[model samples]
Target: MSTFEQKILSTIETNQLMGSDQSAVIAVSGGPDSICLLHALCNLYDKLTATCVYIDHHLRPDESALEAKVVETHCLKRSIGFMSITVDVPAEAEATGDSIEACARRLRYNALEQVRSDVGADIIAVGHTADDQVEELLLRLIRGSGLKGLSGMGFKRGRVIRPLLEISRQEVLAYLDTHGHEFCHDSSNESVRFLRNRIRLELLPVLEQRFNPAIRSTILNTVNILKQEEEFISAESDRFYRSLVRECTNEKDPAGHHSISFATESLTTIPAALRRRLFERACWETGCRPDFQHIDTIDKLLAKPVSGTELHLPDGVRVVRQHDSLLFTKLTEDQGPRESVAYTIEIGQEIEGSGSYVIPVLNRQLDIWLSDSDPRDAQLMRIDRDTITFPILLRSTAPGDRFTPLGGPGSKKVARFLGDRKIPHHLRHLHPVLESDAAIICVLGLEIDERCRITETTTQQLHIRWVKP
Candidate 1:
């Protein structure tokens, strides 16, 4: 085996990047780093199955096709599987308002993940060298990144492994030359419009020549130390997270939202650093990508003496400070607060004798049927047929909407009832309440009105269930 291939094998074994019987989808970009990785992994086909995937960013249409062909030719010669995929990075960037670089990276990883899943591969191997790691660390540092960002990329993250991460770009070129392999040079890499290219082509050379002669090795050493420290801090953060955090499954809260809650007192007891990490963890659990500003804003929220203060965050996530707990909720796009429209169901018309009536606007369905036996499930409300009036109205709560909850002493306003149950303020108006000609029948998924409750003397029972998606 060549020295370069031996280095890669050592790195793979040391990190346990892949199992002996597992297969990998190698992302070959037709560059020296990727080309070298592809050849190296293919040479080890005796131990593991390998497939090559070329992701075309569609930035340079003419060059992309040629790059794919080069990767395909190499795979063909090695008798390995090859797949080509094209992604419209420009269109996605325009749609998402993300920069070209960010969009391309996102779409490229997504495409690679899709290929990995399609091929049933155990892992996706990418050729991110030590040089790339140093460049990434410098870029993130210039952008004012924290400790985790300074750590650079991991050797193995999820199902993606970087086998050549310990190898430098110069070493990659040496390996390619030794094997007499040709690779494509992306012209975009020379363009300074992207910050990364500038760092690699301009900043690093100056830093190496004028400042430190071994700048790359120095940065790599710093990143390695940071990664180890980050792992330890992350472990501690996880310990606190598991002990303090709890998923909120409150039935009164609106559906189609993810929520997690932790006691505010517990947050105060932990150090500020761990508290920030916990905040990030909570936001991640609710599908939010929170930055430093978001975490700082949440920290400010923690200092407030009052409860019920909420701040909107990216990806429809909202952090609300309740009386004793902090609630992080990610609302669905369609679940935003809106004026609820009234939906009506006439006893024998819209909702026939025994059938389900869907409310498309609310994304809910009402299943009503006649039952001789009483409903034991709290979700299924068994009402006395004689108490209900015709043409039931399903509408949001109004000023005068009041109902005596089952086994309650007196009538309570729907708004106050929802507030008492800890329903979010934005979702209060969206809570569905069934109203008959005379009074409010029930608050769906919560409690039925006392007057409509089935009694022992009642012979006929009508069971109504509200289903949410």
Candidate 2:
């Protein structure tokens, strides 16, 4: 059997990588590794039904087009379905601030997955090889990574598969050349500026030449051994997490924010390793994830177990130890508070829009002939033409999140005021807070804009009302 044929068949049987009954999409970049991968899959096309996807990142427009044409021609000559997608490279690279290598990798994978889903392919194959695996292992060590990072990439990730990961780049090139197929050369692959590039060009070569000739084989062998250890550790971590965490909600309200209950004793009982996992999961659940150091600090604090101690972590993630368990929240730097939300009445315009200012016409002012007498006697705040702040702040409400009263002429915390007024607990979270600079204007219908009370200069009026829906 040919060398490539043996490798392909072995990978399929050993890894349970592919089944003849299924279809796949190969992400071919017109490079040797990808071309060899596509070529190998083509041998099984009759049984497996595969297509080729070429992602044309518009970096070097001419080069990209040429590469796409190469892949298209190859696929077409073999009667395999081929497609090319173009994405703006420079804009995306700049937006993400990724190095050329990083940007290209991100765009390439995203485009490939999109194409995979679009084509209804059960598997998507990539072209990583043994040399790439060793380089990655070295890179992960130098960058200070945990066990998960050190474990390297999986042979199968979600719907994506790496068929050539066990082979070397030289073997792939030899296979392609032996079959008389040409492939594009990626110039950036030779650069040594990036750390991975440095490892690939500098360290890997020296290790092979001077000390260990089987470094690539050794790396693969270690990964093969660790795969089972990694899987076992993962299952233990998950089991501990599931047994401890329980979600509680008092019926999800408008904002979709709900209450959850947990035990500190239960959380602390988990092994230290499992505690870290729980902390990370908790942060993600609360729309944030505390950084590594913050997680470590929270884990340490869990030992002594105190309540109400808040730790502000990177990225605005805050954790509060309440009783035994911890609660995660978004932190806000103390800034000058908004004074008030105010607006003037337009002659006959709707006051409803995205702004802090309220210019609602009172129910008393509307003609029974022109408007229905709203059952709720919620009086709309009126103002003169001079009082409105253009483009005011209209936004969602907060917990322990409050507003200042307009007619009452004082600031009241939202939670306390709502509870005192007996506003339905479910409806309070949906209440919109209108603000200008320092104080709250109106709790929509529950209160009025303080600085914008009906004044002597008020000239125009219309009927306006707030409804809970």
Candidate 3:
């Protein structure tokens, strides 16, 4: 057995990458590293059943096809099962709003997953070397990554195993040369436009020449240390997380918004590092991005002694500090049953303006206004007929629209009122408004104009109802 084959076998056994007599899918890109992996896996074990999958990202027209053909011929000569799949990476990138690299990676994994399911493969093996790990560490560092990100890629993540993670690219090329193996080189790796390529080709050589001659080994060592430390922290954080989270309910309100609560005192008692981890956990569970600034803002909120403080986080999540608990709730969409399309409504005429808008009769019997109204209710205000004009326009909120919000000291900008309420920016245009004399009388599903409020002297009322969608 060659040195490369022996090293890979040892790495696999140490990592327990695959079980004895297991089926594996090898992702071969016709590159030196992948070709080495294929040969090593095939040569090292007879019990292991392996197949090759060549992904044609369709980025390069002729070169990509040639690379696939090379991989196919090699697999055929070795009596291995081979499959070539084509993906429109550029089209997928445009559709998903992802960069070319990100989109290609996502689609490639998806295609591999499909093959894994089809073949009932126990694991998928990819040729990611120590060089890739070093590159990733630097990439994450430049991007301001946290501990988890800094740990870099693992030898095994889910069903994907990297037997060559401990091996260097130079070692791979040497192994291929010793075996008289032919491999296809991707020219894109030389392009400076891609960050990874630039890091691999430009930054690495300069660092090796000037700073550390063994920078790759240094990075690998750092990654190993950090990975071990990060694992300990993550496990401890999860243990504390379950205890800190007092209540988690998905069926809280009618809208099915998820709510999670943590004891304020208990949360603050946690170590600063673990506190960040716990907050990150909450953000992940709530489908919110765990941005450093956002997490810091939330962490700072825990220090405030005051209660009833509310913060609107990204992804419509609202964090509220109660008396003894911190509450996190994903705000439900304010879409009401009423359509927000603007149309003029005549007095005493009932028109189904939108799904939420309805004109109810002036009962004046059942006192719906005697008690505090549900702010989310889409009910029409009781405006005196004589005090208002014949035609009251119900339209989507527009610029320059102002309203005297009920119980407010004075008139405020409709936009300002919506902003104060923590309404999401995208949903602002869908908010309905009732206009009279070029003035906003009602900001539907929120507040009615103070002037339109019912009084004892009022003889007639125009009841407008706004229902939550």
State each model's CA lDDT, in order: 0.79, 0.64, 0.74
Which segments of candidate 3 are over 4 A away from where they belong?
Answer: 245-253, 305-308, 335-469
lDDT of 2 by residue, 333-433 (tens): 22101221123333233323221223343311211001122233444433332344322345446666655565665667877877778989776644565
Q: What is the per-residue lDDT of model 1 for residues 337-397, given as tens digits with 9 covering 90 to 100?
A: 2211112343223221333455666666666655576536766887887786444666777
lDDT of 2 at 119: 81
In candidate 1 the C-alpha lDDT for residue 41 amounts to 85
Per-model TM-score on C-alpha atoms? 0.70, 0.65, 0.69
Write one digit per residue (lDDT tens) for candidate 3, span 1-469.
8766788889999989987689999999999989988888888876667779999998888798889999999888778899999999989765544578988999899999889999999899999999999999998898798999999898899999999999998898888888799999898888999998889889989999999999989989999999999999999998888766544433464557777778888887879899898878776777676567667778877777778766545455666777988777764434221212122222333222111222332211111111122243334455544355423465666678788888899989899999999999887754567665556667766787888877787665554555432
Give the candidate number with the greatest lDDT: 1
Error of 3 at 465 (Å): 26
Off by over 4 Å in 1: 246-252, 331-469
True-vs-predicted CA distance for residue 440, candidate 1, Å: 47
Full-model lDDT, candidate 3 = 0.74
Q: Which of 2 and 3 is ahead in TM-score?
A: 3
Best candidate according to TM-score? 1
Quickly count the clashes in candidate 3.
Answer: 15
Candidate RMSDs in order: 16.5, 16.0, 14.6
Q: Model 3: which ten-residue window has the lowest total lDDT?
A: 362-371
For model 1, name the residue pairs that clash.
Answer: none
